[model samples]
Target: MSDADLPFTAALYASTRTEELAPLPWPEEAKRMFLAQQHAAQHAHYQQHYRGMEAWIVEHGGAAIGRLYLHDMPGEIRIVDISLIPEARGQGIGAALLHDLFAQARLRERRVTIHVEKNNPARTLYARLGFTILDDDRGAYDLWEWRAAA
Candidate 1:
């Protein structure tokens, strides 16, 4: 994503983060502030840990709806993150994107991996897409992997 996309991307991140934080009973305004801070920190963490990441802005009907960050290394294509706005979610957009990624990985003969929170609803989708747990011992996030049949 370009610098011009930062605000929109961050807003998308905040929306997804808001859903994850919904169970916490925090005041709306306070949650807003917390989400902003958390977004900045998470962005920084991604920058530091995954250099050369590719950030893509997900769009549909000529409007921005989400962000997908990938760390494409030699043997694996890691889904650094992927999220869609609440309204845009559960509409098969995410599954379509994953199918595209899987096709690309299949051609490249590379595996795909992602770390997702245990309770994230998207984990069900990932499982349905044939992503198996690689490491569930992770505190909150379990590492999942998928590869084409040999």
Candidate 2:
């Protein structure tokens, strides 16, 4: 396959132990821990529902550095989860990945939405991209969404 296809060739697997996710092709530095946790803790959701959820891989220099897990419904696309290793942050990987995903949503005419931990720095990134605050849970996260131009 061509290089462009290579990046899209990233693979995803479910976690059997509900623990750390299987490693991606990127370096450990690129996948830094978040919130004082291993930061690789979401693999369980992917593994358990592998058949139902769709995984999109994000790559840089032909190496997989992150992932975007989505839940697509009739009229909306929920960005159920996204992550970039610490090493990959500040290098524009997140923005690029998000842009591609949202663009896909726009093309399908689906409203795009996601949940973010209040303290995550990516919150600013989403805001800059025009996603607005919709609702929130007092505990830790807020719901955000972006709609197509009317």
Candidate 3:
């Protein structure tokens, strides 16, 4: 993603965390500021971990909608992060993108892996997409992997 995409990216990040922060007693501005800082830290962490990762902006109707960060490692394609605006979710966009990734992995004979938060709703979708848990990080996050059917 380019510098021009920062605002949209931050908005998407905030959307993902809105529900978790909603019940908190913080003011809206404070919550937004915290999310901005968290988003910056997350961006830095991804850059550090996936040095040569591929970045793609998910678009719909010619407008930017989300971001998909991927790393094509030696034996696996790691989905570093995937975020969609709240309005664009639940419409099968994410599933379709993931299915495309799965197809690509199959062609290359590589596993597709992702880590999802323990309580993230997307974990159910990943499981439905045939990803099996490879590691459970003590209830924080689960590492999931999907391999091409033999």
The residue pairs that clash in candidate 2, if any, are 14-47, 30-85, 31-85, 32-86
**Residue 78 alpha-carbon offset, candidate 3, angstroms:** 0.2
What lDDT score is found at residue 125 in candidate 2? 93
Summing lDDT over every window of 10 consecutive residues in candidate 1, give the lowest-scoring window: 10-19
**Every candidate's lDDT:** 0.91, 0.66, 0.92
How far out, in Å, is residue 77 in model 3?
0.2
Q: What TM-score number comes out for model 2?
A: 0.67
lDDT order, best first, reads 3, 1, 2
Q: Which stretches of candidate 3 lie over 4 Å from their true place?
A: none
Clashes of each: 0, 4, 0
State which candidate, 1 or 3, has the greater lDDT. Answer: 3
Best by TM-score: 3
Clashes of 1: 0
Top candidate, metric lDDT: 3
TM-score of 1: 0.94
111, model 1: CA deviation in Å? Answer: 0.3
